[model samples]
Target: MGDTFEAVKEVIVEVMKIDGKDLSMETRFIEDLQADSMDQFFLIDGFCEKFDINISDEDARKIKNVKDAVEFIDKAKA
Candidate 1:
């Protein structure tokens, strides 16, 4: 995996208060992480703050898993 992915994982783990060992690209934020809409908003906000990139509401809604967030940040960073 990429450093971007690791960073994204860190953000998710910190925000969701979950074990890092249990996280993966395929892990769904709502289904697996039990995150609600507010949690999702916080997650997107955290990502933007950490990466210095803004994510639109529509775009944020499309991000469903760790892989999506990592890819989004990677592209935004690029």
Candidate 2:
């Protein structure tokens, strides 16, 4: 996996309170990880806080999967 994937996975693991070892680029926040609605919102908030940037609703809406999140944050950091 790329560095970007690793970073985003870190946020997902931290926010969802799941095992880091269990997270992957293919991991689904809801189905695979069993994350609820609150976990979803908290994941977004935690990601923003970790990156020190605000991810707009439209941009966030694109993040349906881990790959999308990595791309989003990679762009934001760039």
Candidate 3:
């Protein structure tokens, strides 16, 4: 989970162009990071490219926070 969190944090930092020092499992994409719809799209895309996993639209919609993204990626990669 630590590796997954770090990986997800890296993706978020790259895609969002924000500092990752404050990132955490409870951080919210829209609420905390102020990620718009396009940001979310790129985030999902980035995650797919980074983890080599396909995230369906339905599944993508379910990822709202850092924990959600990390957990989803961990599950997909598992």
Task: Write model 1 residue lDDT over 1-78, tens digit each, in one string.
Answer: 479888888888889888889888899999999999989998999899989999999999999999999989989888
Order candidates by TM-score, high to low.
3, 1, 2
**TM-scores, each model vs. reference:** 0.94, 0.83, 0.98
- lDDT of model number 3: 0.96
State the C-alpha lDDT per candidate: 0.90, 0.80, 0.96
**How many clashing pairs per prediction, in order?**
0, 0, 0
- Please report the candidate that would top TM-score against the real structure: 3
Q: Write the per-residue lDDT of candidate 3 for residues 6-61, one digit (tens) a residue.
A: 99999999999999999999999999999999999999999999999999999999
lDDT of 3 at 11: 95
Model 2: CA > 4 A from native: none
**Cα error, candidate 2, residue 43 (Å):** 0.4
lDDT tens readout by residue for model 2, 1-78: 398787787888778777789676777787887877788888889889887879988887777788778878888888
TM-score of 1: 0.94
Looking at candidate 3, the ten consecutive residues that score lowest on lDDT are 69-78
> How far is 5's C-alpha from truth in model 3 (Å)?
0.6
